[model samples]
Target: MTEEPVPVTRAVDFGTAKLLPDVDRARAWLLTVDDAPQSYVDLDDPEHLEFEYTRRIAHVLESAFDTPVHAVHLGGGALTLPRRLALTRPGSRQWVVEADRGLAALVAEHLPLSDPDITVHTTDARAWLAAAPDASADVIVADVFHGSRVPAHLTSVEFLREAVRVLRPGGVYVANIADGAPFAFLGSQLGTVRAGFGQSADLCLLAEPGVLRGRRFGNAVLAAARRPLPLDALARSCAGDAFPARVVTGTALAALTRAPVHDATATASPVPPDGAFTVG
Candidate 1:
């Protein structure tokens, strides 16, 4: 087991994050969490990012709505996806909720998500989720995390209920989860979201199913709405230049909401194999 993290207070540009090195470590982040200063904690791993999968999310959401959708981000990691959305669909309203006050400042300067349109909120992600400008946003993203797990409070059944409350009629809820090694955290989280969203489809790495590539779990962009959102066309259409991959929906979405992880064999099929299988 790795030693507990040493407190970090010094400020340094952590490459992609642009936030202080201390901020990362305190919350058990890459620059700060567990043991070594592994690159995955430093934003070196593109695969673990919301941006890597945002375009696909955007592609699907765009199809769901006739116009640009209102969006919010719970955890501000370099604001990659937010930046992408603002760029792809100009004049869009976005709110980014960051827990770490300093992280907001760091991303304000460094991360690529500096659109004058996006409003950055510095507060507990859950509070902001409830207090956010009411039924104004069309999408609500809750991707906040501490090391691998979302702070337990955030994942509690009650909190998810709150998330369902704030979302628009067909709003999309996206979550980025980290499940690796000997834990079923990923699958369980998937179950939690599935229970909440009612509709979800995974956006995982382009690899074979059940393959635990060490720290390489997968992303579950779970989307749900009080009313069904138009997702098929979104999944079929190619996202413009800025975004890549088609939006996945139907079985794909269901898979994300109810993704299965094979525990009996210790190796299972892809959580949401729809997108991958359809393409293959």
Candidate 2:
């Protein structure tokens, strides 16, 4: 007789989410919150990034350095990217600052980061970033969000400055932002990152062509670095990706950075309208 699979469910502080095993892929799990898919993890294959935005971030990380480097992740959803870093760049030290302690604990209980190099802290990302020492991290990744909306504090110029301050010279800072047509929030964020990193910093935005065109609500990956970004290589990687994405930089990025800068007074990212992310 075949054995029945164990049911997986957890009650996080925000809401109830599930860590369902992928039937077709061994050691793979999908995390969902409020009916929205948040993260996917394949323990057997850490390099397999199932989300387009996540894939874009991974591409930036791969293009940033040839070997493992210290990284700080400002969100810990399923600890997906950190696990990927641990596997892809063995011995890389990583720290994750997640606001939802319950969610963090639940994820750890089910999908533990067996690697000793990755540590998860239950704290606000902004606070952690502010407390971090200068020039301490080689890479800083900001993927923090409450459900689908990123807190305003995390997007403000004040927050971006802390992120920039924590990075080593030539270190890269990457963030995942979601916005709809008009892209006011994304534009402002791009502007904020550029402003924080200064004139010499290289900035790049990556996302599906549709998202870039402001046709619908979607996630965009924004990367900024003190040194020149590897746009050529990143463009090639995105071009060949399963979910073909594009990179916007140079004059094109300048055009998009027209939005006003967001400061501490900014509100949380505008929430998507009902049905914007709903699947039929």
Candidate 3:
């Protein structure tokens, strides 16, 4: 099968990326930044997730709550997850905090969100979370990144605390972190989340088997909540997914959380080496 050409391309503040349509699917579009896959959108089927990490996050959101919820997204790359949320749970109020105005505008003009409940704001994710009222949202998602690396401020304990503070009782906080083998960055982020949520909070880590085993560089979905997460349901969801993944909680999560906690002085997430994700 031939790959679909990107009909539209632009140079944004950070780098250059393009929206490439799926040759087989008329409504599907894949966004890539500097040739690295960033986000995928299926306008016709928001429930159909093309990326493994995104599928994990969607599963968490589905298992986290049964009713429509108020969600705040820290990053807005293509707004794929947000669009899925709006479709799966109608009437849900969603807010997106994105720092790239040009990119946001590009997505708005090209793949405009049909959900009136979804609002986009161009600002720093940390600043927005800090200014948000306490216990104001049922879920908070952190997926902010600069190029391939997550910004230092977003990975700090202070940022996690702010995210937890904005979540209502029994609310969930989920973040998508990318790292390489040994997963030192992932471990530190887990520690930071654990510290912010405390021992009583339910924490779970989901990723591909290879990624979890430190054999590859990939994205991991870290989820935490003030109350117990529906692990049974989450596990079932992961199993049923098209791209099968694994969930680690309880003892395994504790082991991973042994890394040192990161504060405000922490630097950005470690960058993967050159060609880590490049196409052959």
lDDT scores in order:
0.51, 0.85, 0.85
Off by over 4 Å in 1: 1-51, 111-114, 180-183, 197-216, 237-280
Candidate 2: RMSD over Cα atoms?
Answer: 1.7
lDDT of 2 at 188: 89
| Model 3 segments more than 4 A misplaced | 1-6
Q: Clashing residue pairs, candidate 2?
A: none
lDDT-based ranking, best first?
A: 3, 2, 1
lDDT per residue, candidate 2, 202-229, as tens digits?
8999999998887878899999998889
The TM-score between candidate 1 and the true structure equals 0.60
Candidate 3 per-residue lDDT, tens place, 183-214, comes to 77888989889889987888999887878888
Clashes in each model (backbone N, CA, C under 3 Å)? Answer: 4, 0, 0
- Native-to-model Cα distance after best TM-score fit, residue 183 in candidate 1, in Å: 7.8
Model 1 lDDT tens row, 50-138: 23344445554565665666888787655655665665566778888877676556545433343578888878887876675556777
